[model samples]
Target chain A: MKIFVCVKPVPDTAAKIKVGGGASIDPAGVKFVLGPYDSRAASKAIALRDAAGDGSEVVAVAAGNPNKGESEARKRIKDVLALGADRGILIPDESYENRDPLAVAKALAAAIKNEGEFDLVFTGRQAVDDQAFSVGPMLATLLGVPCVTDVVGLEVDGKTATVKRAAEGRVEVLSVNLPCVITAQRDLAEEQYPKLKEILKANKKKIDTFSFEWPAPAYRVTELSPPPEPAAGKIVGEGPDAVPELVRLLREEAKALSF
Target chain B: MSEFRGVDFFLLDELLTDEELAMREAVRTFVDREFIDNRAIEEHHRAGTFPRDLPQKLGELGVLGPTLPDEYGCLGASSVAYGLMMQELERGDSGLRSFASVQGSLCMYPIYTFGSEEQKRHYLPKMARGELVACFGLTEPDHGSDPGGMETKAVRDGDGWVLNGSKMWITNGGIADIAIVWAKTEEDIRGFIVPTDAPGFSAPSIEGKFSLRASVTSELILQDVRVGPEALLPHSGGLKSPLMCLTQARYGIVWGVIGSMMAVFDEALRYTGSRTQFDRPLSSFQLVQRKLVMMHSELTKAQLIALRLGRLKDEGKMKHYHVSFGKRNNCKAAREVAKLGRELLGANGVCDEYQVMRHLMNIESVYTYEGTNEIHTLALGAHLTGHAAFRG
Candidate 1:
C-alpha cells in the first residue's frame, strides 16, 4: 500500500496576526507550524500503512511558498516524516501565497500523479488559515477518485475503506474503494507526538523537492483586514434602582431587548 | 493562554542548531499539553503524589537518558540538546525536571559509565523505555554535603554482598524498581544495583513540606539486603565515582533552574500587564518596571551561562568546578527571579492559579539539591583562591 498525506504550513495558531500593507497577513515575527488537521491526516495515513505492513509506505506531500529560504513547507514535511512517514515530497512555489484552493489542489494532484501509483490520499478537511474547505474535493476530482470529507472515523480492509462522518446529527457511513481521498476531521485520528529518536532520524530521511505551475486563480482576495475592536461596555448603574433605566436603554438605545 | 514563546532576550536561540531548536520545541509542546493545559502539576501538587504517568510519556518522547547512546534505546542527543530538554521540563515543574535528572544523570549515567557490559545490557534499555524506574542512593541520613561520611556498608558473604544502609532525600525512591546504592566496603566505596523488591529493602515516602510537592522524596532503608556479585558496578570505586554522578546531575540543574525562572518571569510579566492597581496597569509603575527589568536581565544571563556550560560539556572541556559555577549562579538567579515574580503578583502570588508561587516554592528545592548553593560557592571559592572553605 502506498499512502500520500498532504500537509501545509500555516502561521502558528497562537501567533499575533497583523494586516500587512498589501492586504495580507504580516509574516514578520510569526512562527509557522504544520496545520493541525493536516497532522491528523498524516497520523491516520501512517497508522493505515503500518496496519497494512507488507511493504507499505506512507509518503508526506506538502505544497507552499518556500518564503525566502525559510523553507517552512519543507520543515513541515520533515515533521510528518518524524511522525512515521517513510518519505516526503515538497512542492515549492513562490506564488503560493496568492494561490486559491483550486490552484493549490491542482499542484498537489499533479505531484501525487507524478509520484507513481498510490492507494490512498489524505488531507485536512480545511486549512485553519483559509478554511476554504474545497481542496480535498477538488484534488479528488482531478485524480478521478471518490472523496469523503470531514471524516471522523475510518477503517480500511482489503481494497475498500469505511469512512464515518457526522451529518445533521447523524453519522453518515460510506464505503469507498481504494485509490480514494480522505479529508480528516478532528476525531479522525489521535495526534502522535514523535519520539526524539524519530525526530533525529527524520533529519536523515529523503524529501524530494518538486515544482508545479499552477493555473490562474479563479478568485482573488481583494482585501484582508483584522476584525474590528469590540465596543466598550457601558455600566448602566449598580443596583436594582437602575434596572428600569437599563431595560429602557436596552430596548431603545442598545436595541438588545427584542421582547 | 498563548503559547510560550520562550524568554530569549539575548537572542541565545541564534546559537542553537536546527536539531537543538527542534528538540526544545518538541519538549516544550509536550510540557504544555501534559503539564500545564491538563493542570497535572497543580493536581499532583495538591494531592502530594508524584505524576507517575509522566515517566512513560516522557520516555515515549525519548527524554529519559536522552544523552545516552541510541543502542540502548536512547536518543544520543547532544549536550546542548539535553540541557534544553531539562530547561523545558523544569519550566513545567521543578519536580518533573528532577525526575528526569535523577533517572538520566544519576541512574543511567552511572550504569553506562561504570557498570559491567552485562548490567548495561540488562538495565539500560528498560530504563530508557521508562519500564524500569531507578533511584540514586548517595545522600544518606547523616551525610549530604560531606558524602565521605556515609555509613552505609556492603560486606562480602559467600559470593554476594550484604548491604545495610539508609539513604535520605532520594528522588523517585518510593516508586523506583532499582536503586543505584553506594555503600562503603573495606577497600573503598562501591556502587551496587539493588532491586527494591529484595528482602530487607524498604523505601518509605517522606511527607514533603512546601517544596517540590509534586515529586516523591523517600528514605531508602536497607537491612541485610543481599545481591549477587553481578550486581556490582565493575568500574565504580572510591568517593569520586558518586561525586562524578553528582557532577552530571548538577550540570542538568544548571539548566533546569533557568526553566523555573522563565516560568515565573513570564507569569509575572503577563500578570503585571493586565492587573490594574491605580487606574493603570501595574506595569505602568516605575517600581514594577524595575522588578520586571531585573527578572528579565537575570534570566538572560542565566540562559547564557547554561548555553556556554552545555557547549563546554559537549567539547569535553568542562571541569567539575565549571559545573559548580553554573549551578551556583543559575540557582541563585532563579531563586531571586522567582522572588521578584512572586512580589509582583502581590496578593495573587500565593495562589496556584498564577503558577509564580509554584515556581517560587519549587526553586527552593532546586537551590538546595545536587549540591547546595553554599557548597557550590565554597567549591568555586576553593577553585579561585586555592583554599578549601568547606571544612571551616
Candidate 2:
C-alpha cells in the first residue's frame, strides 16, 4: 500500500510568541515543531505501513521553499520522515505567509497527485498555528476522495477502512473504500519519538521538491491578535445560600438550564 | 506565555548535530512523560527500592552504551550524543543516570575496551540490549578515592581464579546479572567478569540513604568466588585500567549535572512567578531576582563548560584533568543551585512535590562521587604547582 502523510510545522505552543508591528508574528528565535495533530496523522500513516509489512511505502508531503534556509516547511517534511516515513516530498512555494488556506490546500493536492496514486492519505485535523482546519477537507474535495475528520481510531482491512471520529458528546464510526483521506485528531495514535539512528537516516534521505503555480486564493487573513483574557468569576453568598444563586446564575447568565 | 522548558542559554544546541538534538528530544520526552509526574519515584526513593523496569525501558531506547558500536545493539553515536542522553536522564533523577552510567561506562566499556573478542561478542550485545544488567566493582569496602589500595584478590587456580573480597557502593548491584570485578592479581590489578549467581558472590542492598535513594546501591561479597580463565579481561592491566572507566563515567556526570541544575532552575522560575508574596509575585522581589540571576548564570556557565567537554571527549582529546574540572565544578554548582532553588520555594521546597529538596539531596551524592570536589581541586592544584598534595 502507498500512504501519504501531510504535515505542517508550527511555532511551539509553549514558546513566547511576539506579535510584530505589522500584526505578523516574529518567526526569529521561535522554536518550530510538527503541528500536534499533524504528528498524530504522520504517526498513523507510519503505523499503517508497518502493520502492512514489506512492500508498503509511507511518503510525507509538505509545502516549503528550499531557498529559505531553516524554514519551518522543510523541517516539517523532515520531521515526518524521521518518524519512519519512507520518502519525503516538498512543494516549493515561497509565498506561504500570504497564501490563504485554499491556496495551501491546492499546492498540497498537486504534490500528492505528483507522487502518483496513493492508497491512503492522512492529514492533521488542523494546524495549531492559525487553526484554519480547512486544508484537509479542501484537499479531499479536490482529490474527489472520501474524507473523514477528527478520526481518533482507524482500522484497515485490504481496501476497506473503518474510522472512529469524535462528535458532540458521541463517537461516530464510518467505513470507506480504498483511496480515502483521513484527518487525524489528537488521540489517533501516540507519536513515536525517533532515536538517533533514525534521525541520522532521515537527515540523509533527500527530500524531492516540486514547484507549482499558486491558484487565486479564496480567502485572506486580516489581522491576528491574542485571545482576550477571561473575566473573573464572582462569588455570591456561602453554603446553602450560594446554591440558589448558583442555580439562578446557571439558568440566567450561563443559559445552561431551563425551567 | 508559558514558561519555556528548553533553556539553551548559549545556543549550545546549535553546536549539536541534528541526530544529537533528536536523540536528546526523545529522551527528554520520555523522561517528562514517565518520571516528572511520577509520585512513585519519590515513594521508591523513600522506600529504597527503585523500579526495576526502568532499565528495560532505557534499553528499549538503545541508550545503554549508545556511543558503543551498533553491531552490539548500541547506537554507534558520538560521545557527545551519549553525554546528552545522560544529561536528560539525570534531569529526571540522578539515580536513573547513575544506573545508566554504571551499566554503560563502567561495565560495558571495560568489556569492549579490554575483553577478548569472544567476551565482547558475548556481553556487549546482551548488556547493550539491557537483557543482562551489569555493575562495576572497583571501589572496595576501604578503597574509594584510592582504589589502588583495594584488597580484593584473585589467586591463580588450576584452570581458573578464586576471587575473595567485597565492593561497596556498587550501583545496580543486587539486581545486576554480572559484575565487572577488578581484583589484584600476582602481576597487577586486573578485571574479571563475575556473574552475580556465581558461588559465594552475594550482592546485598544497602539501606537508609539520605541521598541517591532511588539507586540500587549494594555491597558485593565475593567469598572464594571462582570463574574460568575466559572471565578475565585479557588486555586490562594496573589501576589505570579502572581509572579509565571512572574518567568515562565522570565525563557523563559533567553533562548530567547540567540537567539536574536545569530541572531545579526551571521549577524555581515557575515557583517564583506563580507564588505571591506581599500582594505581589515573589519574582518581583529584588532578593528573589538576585537568587534567580545567580542560578541562571551558574547554570549557563556549567552548560557551556559541559558542551566544550563533550566536544573534547568526542574528539578523543579529553584528559583526566578535563573530566575532573568539569565534574567538580558542575557538581558543586548544582549543589549551590539546588539549595537556592529550595530556599526560593520557601516551605514548599522541602517537600517532594516541588522536587527541589530531592535535587538538593541528589546533588550531595554527585558532589562526592566520581572524585570529590576536594580531590579534584588537589589534582588541579598538583597540575599547576608541580607538587603532589596527596602526602601533605
Residue B45 displacement in candidate 1 (angstroms)? 0.2
lDDT of 1 by residue, A1-259 (tens): 9999999888889888888478568887777888889999999998988899889999998887777555888889988998889999888888778888888889999999998898999999888988899999999999999999999999988899988986644689999998999999988998666778888999999999888977787887879878789889888898999999999998778778755
DockQ for each of the predicted structures, in order? 0.61, 0.54
Residue-level lDDT of model 2, residues B1-392, one tens digit each, is 22328578888888888678778887887777667755666777777778788878888777899888878778788888898899898888899999999999999999999999999889998888788999999988888888889999999999899999999999899989999999999999999999999999999988888899889899999999989999899999998999999999999999898889888999999999999879999999999999999999999999888888888888889888898899889999999999999999999998887778998999898999889999899888888899979754
Pairs that collide in candidate 2 are: none
**Off by more than 4 A, model 1:** A67-70, A214-223, A231-259
What is candidate 2's CA lDDT for residue B294? 94
For model 1, the docking class works out as: medium
In candidate 1, list every pair of residues with a backbone clash: none
lDDT of 2 at B121: 88
Q: State how far residue B375 of model 2 sits from its true place (Å).
A: 1.5
Q: Candidate 1, residues B1-392: lDDT per residue as tens digits?
A: 33666788777877997688888888888888888988888998878889888779888898899999988889889999999999999999999999999999999999999998889989999999888999999999889999999999999989999999899999999999999999999899999999999999999999956989999899999999999999899999999999999999999999998899888988888899999988999999999999999999999999999899999999999999999999999999999999999999998999888788888888888899889989998999999999998765
